[model samples]
Target: MYIRDVTKVDIETVARISVEGWRHAYRGIIDDAVLDGRSVGEAARQWQEWLEDLVRRGDRLAVADDAGQVVGFASYGANRDQDNGFDAELYAIYVDPDRLGRGIGTALVRDMGRWLEAHGYEDVVVWCLKANPWCRFYGRSGARPVAQRIIEIGSRKLEEIGYGWHTMATLREE
Candidate 1:
């Protein structure tokens, strides 16, 4: 598999990944009704706007392509909310539910770190629902718990944990 920048043709595929990833990974951690209500069309629309915005900001949106199939994707940019010493933020990352545990996420994250560092960003931050098992992935990627907050999703209040890397080198490490 290889990672590449997202293109307009990838919108539907990555949209599916985003919706499915949320439904599978956030099942117990988020409201059931919220997950069930997600539709690829809506996700694609949001992704369209987000993609345009990322380009406007000179940020990035990338996908993991496996034999022409998109299995995962990630986005990052100048930190929207500067905290600690981090100057960049990983906005989102989702592996196709069927592709989990195959190191796609690791590759995406490593690429993100490389891209950020090459752009002169020193550190990065990412946030996940506090109850998300995916936090384990962040921990494995050399991120430590650095911040926390409460966010409301579909009328439900959820706690989120922010993970941080003090140095981009941590992510570039093998």
Candidate 2:
């Protein structure tokens, strides 16, 4: 597997992974109707919009490619929360449902740190749904709980926990 900045050609596959991920990964936590209603075409449109913002904000989306398929992706950028002190934010990370547990997430997080560091960012924050099992992964990665807020989706309000590191060095693998 390899990680690289996304190109226009990758949007569709990335969208598919993201939509499928929300459907599979959040099955029990998120509203079933909400997840079931998401469409790849809509996701692709949203990604296109994010790509446009990426150019203007100097942010990026990177994808993990395995034998020509985009198995996972992560987006990072300047922190959007004005009250937060984090230098950057990991906006999202989603791996193909079928590809989980194979270290793809590890590779994606590693690459995210490298990319953010290269661009002069030090502190980083990532917000995960409180019920997401992957929250454990963030804890193991050295992210301390830094903040919390409620986000509403399809009539349901869920808590999101923000995790952060004062320095990316804490997130690097041994």
Name the candidate that leads on lDDT.
1
| lDDT for each residue of candidate 2 in 1-174, tens digit (9 for 90 to 100) | 999989999999999999998887789888889998989999999999989898789998999998888889999979999688998999999999898888888888888888899999988999999988878888877789999999998878999999997787876765
Q: Which ten residues in a row have the lowest lDDT in candidate 1?
A: 79-88
Error of 1 at 62 (Å): 0.8
TM-score, every prediction: 0.97, 0.95
Computed on alpha carbons, the lDDT of every model, listed in order, comes to 0.93, 0.89
Candidate 1: where is the Cα deviation over 4 Å?
none
Q: Highest TM-score among the candidates is held by which one?
A: 1
